[model samples]
Target: MNIKLIAIGKTDNKDLENLTNIYQSRLGFYINFSIEIIPDIKNVKKLSEEQQKQKEGLLILSKLSATDAVILLDENGKQFDSVGFSSYLQKYMNSGIKQLVFVIGGPYGFSPEMYTKANGKLSLSKMTFSHQMIRLFFIEQLYRGFTILRNEPYHHR
Candidate 1:
């Protein structure tokens, strides 16, 4: 199955972008991994938190197809260790799904409608992280997950 990471905005930090790219390239060897960035909402200063989430939700939903299985990377979602996450990926690969989409929402978080559309929710951590930083962290976790699945030496017990 293919894996897609859909985040709401771009990363301006060059370091973060480069680091994310490193993991992105490594992920390409194991899965069809792609990062789709939905541009940040213009006039965000004029909009309320809820409005921003609503607008971002529309954009996120627009990128999805009916067949894609969406999983939101939410702060309150289920937490898993590296091994468990690898197992999760293994289960999806075994299920014959076409695409596994993971979304990192905007600054304020996901709208109620977006939450409704999600098939599952996964938490990278309980502590808050910048929207941009999460992209890099998630990509690295994905790389680690795949390596663990392949019985590689990347992940340590």
Candidate 2:
């Protein structure tokens, strides 16, 4: 199965973008991986938090295909160890899913509509992380999961 990461706004920080790209490339060796960046809403300063989430929700929903399985990265979701996460991915692939879509929501988090649309939620850690850092963390974890699945030396217990 292919994997896609959807996020709002571009990572303007050069260091973060480069690191994310490196993981993206490493991921390509194991699966068809892609990252889609939804442009930031114009003049967001004038919009309230709820309004921004609603707008971002519409854009996030638009990127999804009918068959895609969406997994949202949320703080309140179930937490798993590295081995558990790899097993989770294996289950999805074994289930013959076409695309596994992971979304990292914007500043104020996801809207109600987004919550309704998600297939499941995953929490990377108990600690809260900035959205930018989450992107980097998620990508690296994805890469590490694949390596672990293949019994590569890159990942260890």
Best-performing candidate as measured by lDDT: 1
The TM-score measured for candidate 2 stands at 0.96
State how far residue 83 of model 1 sits from its true place (Å). Answer: 0.5
How many backbone overlaps does candidate 1 show?
A: 0
TM-scores, each model vs. reference: 0.97, 0.96
Give per-residue CA lDDT, model 2, range 1-157, as digits (tens).
8999999888878999899999999999999999998998999999999999999999999999989999999888888888789999999999998999999999898999999999999999999887878899999999988998999988864
Candidate 1, residues 99-134: lDDT per residue as tens digits?
Answer: 999999998999999999999999999999898899
Consecutive 10-residue window with the lowest summed lDDT within model 2: 148-157
What lDDT score belongs to each candidate, Candidate 1 first? 0.93, 0.92
TM accuracy, model 1 = 0.97
Candidate 1: deviation at residue 108, Å? 0.9
